[model samples]
Target: MTIIRNIFHGFLRAMSSNSKIPIAPVGVRGMRDLDRTKFSLNVILPVLKVREEKLSKISNILKQYFLKLENFKPVQAQDAVTKCVYFNPEKITQWNEFSEKDKSIFQEHNIDHTSFSLQSVQLSYDNFKIDTIFKAVLPENEETVSGFSQIGHIIHLNLREHLHEYRHLIGQVLLDKIKTCKTVVNKSNIIDNTYRNFKMEVVAGTEDYFVTVKENRCNFQFDFSKVYWNPRLGKEHERILSFLNPNDVLFDVFCGVGPFAVPAARRKCTVFANDLNPDSFKWLNHNAKHNKVNMNIFRSYNLDGKDFICDIFQKFVSNICDGTEKLKEGAKIHVTMNLPAMAVEFLKHFNGLLRNKENTVHVEIIAYVYCFAIGDDPASVAKKMVSDNIGRDISTSILDVFNVRNVSPKKEMMRATIRLNDVIFNELQEPPTKKVCV
Candidate 1:
């Protein structure tokens, strides 16, 4: 009886071992995790050695059918033979369909493909799965893929702890696949809890840290590894700028590299931008010039938002209302505290922030505070927290609440646009004003 039981168990183990496994989930929509196969029909057209300069002129002919697989590289310095790869091996008919314009471009540039060689070559790809051109250098388990930051010409990956071993391969793949990415790096320790910068390891490509990028018709250039910059806030910055007019004043208490300030300045709104990071201060000044914003109207400061509000921000408001009464207040002055982690606490400064202590000023001061909250209802959680910190009953005066993005499984980042009540300006008489926000 024991021998029969043992034989049955062995049979069950064999069956389990032979069972087919399920396919792994594709974590991100754009990620390619499969292997790429070599196709024999891949096009390989080598331009004539003498007329290589004409390659660019005729390349558009190829782009009509195939994606560019490889950039031009010197085949031989002596013969001046250069070659570029067109990704399409399947579009051979397009080559025959070439127009006279293409031939004329070839004729004008003296390019000919007479000595071209066509052959099958296995395109080297790191992924083991089929049909994937570029595979992420995944962890040993291949499950978690974190988001990355593209700074200028660099792509910075904040990989999980398990992905360190494959960092180099991943960096190399990114450099090869991302035409604009000259350098790929793995960021360790993340943005410092206090300093807000990361330790970077360059896994592949150039080591240059300086980068240039454009957002909302504004150009920004900065050090990718040293400074803090988030492309995700491009729209948020624009949204705030859209609310302000040319004659208004903007106080970007935590402005990093003028992402918010430069555009506001361009809109003709005088801007007083400040940051705790010196790099951000320098770059903010640089971007102000880079964007051709009027320097006369823009100010950059290296200070914590808490101090900045007390000094530069106060001076800005004082100068704005130096002659004019505080009648048109809320519509004219705007304060943006964007450090989501600390912005809510910064609201305490507004408890007794402004002077003039009137029941209703000409216009009220509008504060846009960004915060991160974790709960089933992030808006209510953040709204309550904002109310408690500022000492005002949020039963009224919370103008607009925006859910920025989901940072994690349960945590969300949000923005609350609140009109400063008279109660916030030194606990004065709370009087009702126009409900409409300009």
Candidate 2:
């Protein structure tokens, strides 16, 4: 009838001191299914003066027949000369069945031991997924739960229409299950294409709008209620940004909250960032200053992507021609169009981009255009779409095409990286015929 109150802390023989993996306690609650019959009956071992080398041998033997709870420290009286160690033995009454060699070690030191009354506890490795939890709590037909997006501290749920009533329960469960999330919101409206923001109702936690997102070694602060921020594209931004060098030029069209422009500027690349959404522009400026990007190198613009390209391209070409804008040899020049829905169609604006200029800009002008396409092979479809929209033959223009992610079962987001200089600046090529969509 012993109640074990002692906990022990030390690395076991198998554990390393510098392991990065997070260690869970013997029992942790994670909304998991539990079996009532299975539990550990702890055995409290009396402290003994044993050789330092024998600790491993004694621990190994204890682990053979009981649960070896590692990394637990004992709480004892301040003046106590020694502390007790604990183990959870499955068969509490079988302590006398040990071999004679093991019995000598325990009996020789007179280390008294007692068994603890069994207590229910959760296992660390249990099936605690949201799908299972939802299915258990929700009705079968109404359990149409669409997945959620982890945006900053918020769990953004765009649940299927049928699951609206359970949004609060779902949000609370998500908040409880996740360690980092503080707030949860259900999307009230679909994403607004023009502004890229969405209406949301707070289902759990505080009514908060301000959130800071860290990505690509940069921190960005934005009003989540007013601007758009997606945590999923952090890797994609870093991937393309690795191609840039100091003194390179980046024109980020539809640069929502400066995900691309701010990090590029941090790399010492000159950035001209633009977005039609006023909130995005304001946050872009704010984030650039907050991140300590050189204002001389980073400039924010509020204009449509079409206007940003047509007007800014002319100005950059003008500066390149007049020798006002200086760049290092082989410095890359990039035009980033990130509005996946319309960015590909925006390529037509670049057809006659540098044609009429007398500027001999010796820089590689590259276009990183994103789009959404539906097909089995969305990458190929995106490449052909870019070729047709930019009015260039696909054979000579494609530098690379990436299947970004699946938006849905049929729809996919893609990025087509093309060197616009090869096709646009070619004298034999005709000016692009399609109108710009952005």
Query: Which candidate number maximizes TM-score?
Result: 2
User: lDDT: which candidate is best?
Assistant: 2
Clashes of each: 12, 5
N/CA/C clash count, model 1: 12
lDDT per residue (tens digit) for residues 26-134 in model 1: 3322432322332112222222233356556566665554433343232324344555443333333222234677666666765545523233223233212221322
Off by more than 4 A, model 1: 1-141, 318-331, 421-423, 426-438
Give the lowest summed-lDDT range of ten residues in model 1.
Answer: 38-47
lDDT of 2 by residue, 268-295 (tens): 9999999999999999999999999999
Residue pairs clashing in model 2 are: 7-73, 8-72, 8-73, 9-72, 9-73
TM-score of 1: 0.67
